[model samples]
Target: MNYLVKINAVKTTNELEDAWSNEDYKALLARFEYPDAAQLKPAELKEYLFLAISDFEPHEAAAILLDYKCSDQLVDGQIDNLSHEMLRTKTFENYSEIDLHHDLFNINQLLYSAYNGKFPLGTVNLVEMEIKGDDNVEELTKETALKALSYGLSENNLINRLLSDQIEGHKAFPEAEGIVWELQHKGDDVYTLTISEKWLTKTEITNPEYECTVVPFEEHQEAN
Candidate 1:
């Protein structure tokens, strides 16, 4: 089920817009601050402004911010609202990290980057553990992985097609699917996709002429 967040107040619309245009996150926090309350410092204000303008639940985000100790700049009391004021305040930026081995900490980095456009600092040590209790969930079997490889692109998820290709190519032979695409925040784009071939089956495909009768592939049907 989808959750809803309600923000009831916008004390001064003009001030909010001005802050957004200038990317003045500190000023934005001060604007949203409760009257006669202590102001947040610049570092703390950056995170609070990000949380306030985000689409995520304010409380949930606030919890993360507090965990990160970035919540100190926000105002006290119940926060009930969704606003784009924060996004409008900053330009989109790209950040990436490459780790030789995967770790749970990597997931945390993804979480931070996805939500806040910031990367974590320092090295994250890892310890291996045996995880259990996941039997209820169906695993992505070979069949499902193979099928996904043949799937085509759609407006909804242009990135999915790239994944599909990589999985198919991998099943056929071993090769890295890294360097999936060159991302751009503007202009026409080109996407490079690779899928493992370990997943493909040699099946005859019947292509019909415009006047002939036939059913198109599932991918084509879905796209239409």
Candidate 2:
């Protein structure tokens, strides 16, 4: 399931538009290599902002901000600013990591770039797992397909050992309907890659902002 994070508490008309109106984000589409990566249409700019800002549970995000430990920056257990907002987001259920990867891939497709260690795990999943999962993959670039295949990730997963954290390198996951190649990366790439395994099984919501029970993927579909 994917997270449906919503801003909580009282709502104001103005609210926060920083993410909604940010223009600088458009420049970031370059990594994906767009025809006009240097310039973005207004609609495109605002759309990407929502994704960047919308990610993360409010409390989980807040904890990383200044004065979170002391609660100085928070007002009444909440921060209004999106960056460090204490009670900014309340997560609903049924958001798929697969969907998140797909959505983010759609966004990234607008840009021009190559995937590497620096790419977000979401982006990596886009180039790696999601594309392969497609029933009809008409065409995939050699470089792109090679990079993804080398990672040992299968569209499906196997569980030879339950709850075993041992590093098995690349092995087939039984749950995977067919061949499975495990994904492993070093350095900053780990942030997104490791999350695939470590993330709360979509069952564990240790983070206060995320809820255990959730919604389905279709209900919260955003405009494409």
Candidate 3:
């Protein structure tokens, strides 16, 4: 669990300064909209920016931090489905976990939240060990274990399947568990692979088709 906190602090300070220079912060509040940078506590502002920084150009990330709204609704810590202000209200101070899988920020947001005790931006974790008859020591191992429930899919089984024939030669990612067939039909050969990061599993999203979005573990963080 490598933690990165300094960068977030710097970004937050920058946003606060921007809001101070412009009346945008006051105007946003007067409209009953999300608070602007200056209105945000530096810690909260940093978490928000961190959550929204994935797949964004450096300048774009900066712009978003300066202009977006920050509110509790926008505080899921994921950048997707949020206006600038909505994103600003996210602070790791309140949330126990941060999800950063898809709503935005990808892995970077997760990394940021991990340091601050917020959940990852877009992931959920299951207690594989506490399923049934498991010992405490074994349960500890199971914490890192992955299971498909129905097919008795374990992390090893999942990875082996991908290695054998499932993913078509795409290498298994390091922090990722294994692809789980979330939905499967009798006739259709398609299944949704439940991808996950180190400590959290992403919530299943309906893709409406057979396509799988496999982002390389390295590229899964922030796009260069």
| Global lDDT of each candidate | 0.27, 0.27, 0.30
Model 2 stretches with alpha carbons more than 4 Å out: 1-12, 16-39, 60-85, 88-224
**Tens digits of per-residue lDDT for model 1 on 92-171?**
11112111112212222323444654333212211111111123253322223223322322323323344444333333
95-134 per-residue lDDT for model 3 (tens digits)? 2232322223322243334334332243322222112222
lDDT of 1 at 133: 18
Better of 2 and 3 by lDDT: 3
lDDT head-to-head 1 vs 3, winner: 3
TM-score of each model, paired residue for residue: 0.18, 0.18, 0.23
Model 2, 1-224: lDDT tens digits are 22222211211121112312233454333322234634656766645433443353433323332122224423543323322321222111112223232222222222112221122222122111222223233333322222232233232322223312211223222322111112222232121111222222222222212211122223323311
Write the candidate numbers in order of decreasing lDDT.
3, 1, 2
Span of 10 residues, lowest total lDDT, candidate 3: 5-14
